[model samples]
Target chain A: MPHLPPLLAKPVDIAPLWLVERVARMIFSCVLKAHPDLFARLGDYRESRYCFSPSDLQLHFRVVPATQALSVSRGTPPPADAHIEGPIALLLGLLEGRCDADALFFSRDLSVSGDMEAMLALRNTLDDSAIDLPRVIGSFGGPFSPVVTGFARYIRTRVLEGRETAWN
Target chain B: MELICPAGTPAAFREALEAGADAVYCGFRDETNARNFPGLNFSREELRQSIALARRKNVQTFVALNTFMRAGDEALWYSAADDAVALGADALILADFGLMAYVAERYPQQRLHVSVQASASNPDAIRFLVETFNAKRVVLPRVLTVQDIARLTSQIDCEVEIFVFGGLCVMAEGRCSLSSYATGKSPNMNGVCSPASHVRYREEGGSLVSELGAYTINRFGSGEASGYPTLCKGRFDVAGAEGYTFEDPVSLDVIDEIDALRAAGVSALKIEGRQRGRAYVAEVVSVLKKALGATSAERAPLVSRLRTLSEGQRTTSGAYDKRWR
Candidate 1:
């Protein structure tokens, strides 16, 4: 229930889409590097595209699992085989496999469209990966590892305030 | 009645325990268990750790080896049973008669539970299993009405357990081949039904369509809540009526009938959804535990809190009411 930061609270379309897309791609690459087998377990759905829409930010992030590609956009939202819309925090909570996707979905805190089966495929794959975002981000740095990891953990704590994590 | 809960992973298992679960049931991360979904279930190491933890908390652990045995897969089922007993599982929930016989003969002192997959609806079948294998408990199939459950509980000699919440299988438990016919996999054989591997969803003309294997399962308009594509909950044409012939997409929630269930001699109330996450398990277990502690007049609202967690955001007592012919 925490209000988003002033910068992110602004209409996402007003931001430079290229810059955001570039930063998002870098993070996605880091995640894939940390867990190389992340999407391999998706089976057939690994060939599918998944769209993550942040209802609060009005932004869409379409990820192509086969190619390990991510694109950021607004308006029409890229065509994908599976799509989920929620607060940006909840979406990132899913990124680290911290929040339970089924719980949020059942509560109507989020909406999923397109291929539910494919989405489930993605969910199961993500759940087992045990991806910890703070560790993944911190591993990339030598001198600044502590600072970056600490900052990342702080952000995660704020983002997931009033929410239950995987540890319950 | 004791509250039994499902846990697909170690995390979910802990959540259930923390939420006041009397017993936590889980399966190995393989086809030996009915909920053999990918990225879920326990490793031998995980189950060992879970059992160690459960012992400290004095909570029982039930390991499900409920799937039917296949010709070449007998060893897997046998090995799973050995490991579960070795890890000190409080009980082994078994369905296959062959496996049951093997376990009964080999581990004579180990407690055995007749899995619902056995579909022992009648007293004769229940008594046969109890006499044959010395089964301690029988999880009644979800097809029976509350009245039938009460009558059967009275007639049977073993302890009775019934499904109180989560997914409802319209077909007779353990005997249906609908999922196999559609997806070439079944809960009894492969531990999956309408598996994600063979399922597809697409939007056509503003309606979302769900398909399993090659057949259409269900369709939802713009605002209608979508549902799991289990074949039993699908829409199909039957006798000139193109509608949901089997069941609507609603989870079975009979928590409000807990007092009645206790009166009928149900030893445990089982919650389904081994495929669900920790949050769902924690919430449902906590809510049910609270409802059990509440007075009869205070129980309905506790059950109402579970509405959001139910499938399709709706709830049903299912066959418990016996409202339909």
Candidate 2:
């Protein structure tokens, strides 16, 4: 697990489910614009609903694709075409191709249910692109872009160093 | 010491030979090889071409029929052995006792190297494999410390091959059943661990999540890089403490201990990662080739270069350093 700055960690741990959901919706809205090709490929999932759950934070989101926008809900929206669950870091890793999907799944770090073809398509698409979350998020910060980038770099460094210390 | 490397494709096989690998190991594109990932491995025709290429360069070619044979599917593995010999491979790397027996009896003139999947760590076990299957060399499992390996080397009759670098498996190679329990596919039986068809990733509540089958193996905080989730390397909550319960997500790297390993009577140094691409194989083989020839002072920089390619951006001496115990 990645180590969070104590100040940020506490608030996040205590944050309400609704707030978390709202933030996810906003970030994903920007993400879809940044990678239109990725969302376009998800056209096969047009009528499908997918559920994503982060177990540690006890948060979940139901996602559906519309013609131009994605509809996301905080609580159980409906029966999903596929369900994916794990930790926040791994989900991001899959998007960025920083983590190997097969390796994580083999270790039982991540899981998926229903619609195997949809899942494979998503995986292959992500693997083909370089989706850096920090850069994507920072792209929207305008004047604060440098600050956002710096903070993201710092947090990433801290997490990597902590993991190295623990493992080595 | 001989430097052995892995080649998943015919292109990688040629790359390894050109990059100074003393020998290159590869397998057919089937369940017969441990790295049975899609789009990887060679067909029989490809292997024949690869062997011919290695012959011209005077480099050895070893075929790995390392996965264990299922009871009803022995013919598939048996045919792999027969074809590898027919293709004039320099040696055969085998893991199963029955397959070993079959190869030993039919092809007495062929050389055999015991695969690491056999998990033969001790001298007695190594000796048994040598006597029973006529294994000329044994690839030691990654569980032994340097001193333990040195001790075993002194007693064993055959040559010993040690993994010098690449991905680390915390569990005993052939004995691990964690994948089978969750995925219904065993590396020993199906030649894959954590098959990709079962992996899924999702975004929830501002956090990204990764899962395998029905299990939530790990969670990462925002901005943290996630690692491949092998069961042993995943973090878990044990007794209110949340951390890695078995092993951490780190690759094995023992370049710093080359002198010690050489002194310990290791005859060959193996580099893992057949599932990796030709570029990875080429870069690693080139650097390690220089390191193998360099003096102690010259090796430090070369070792650092290889670290950038490690699995988790972190490297460990693994069991070579007893502190890990």
Off by over 4 Å in 2: A1-168, B205-207
True-vs-predicted CA distance for residue A108, candidate 1, Å: 7.1
Using TM-score, give the best candidate's number. Answer: 1
lDDT of 1 at B251: 88
Model 2, position A6, has a per-residue lDDT of 58
* Interface RMSD after interface superposition, model 1: 3.8
> TM-score of chain B, per candidate?
0.98, 0.97
Candidate 1 chain A minimal-lDDT segment of 10 residues: A159-168
lDDT of 1: 0.84
Highest DockQ model number:
1
Per-prediction interface RMSD in Å: 3.8, 9.4
- Residues B180-250 of candidate 2: C-alpha lDDT, one tens digit per residue: 88788777888887765565566566444656677776775654545565677777889999998887767
RMSD of 1: 4.1
Over 4 Å off, model 1: A1-11, A21-51, A55-87, A96-100, A103-118, A125-168
Q: What is the Å distance of residue A83 in model 2 from its true position? A: 16
List, residue by residue over B53-92, the lDDT tens digit for candidate 1: 9889999999999999999869999999999999999999
Q: What is the C-alpha lDDT profile of model 2 across A81-154, one tens digit per residue?
A: 77777666666666655554544543356667677546654554454354667887777679999889778766
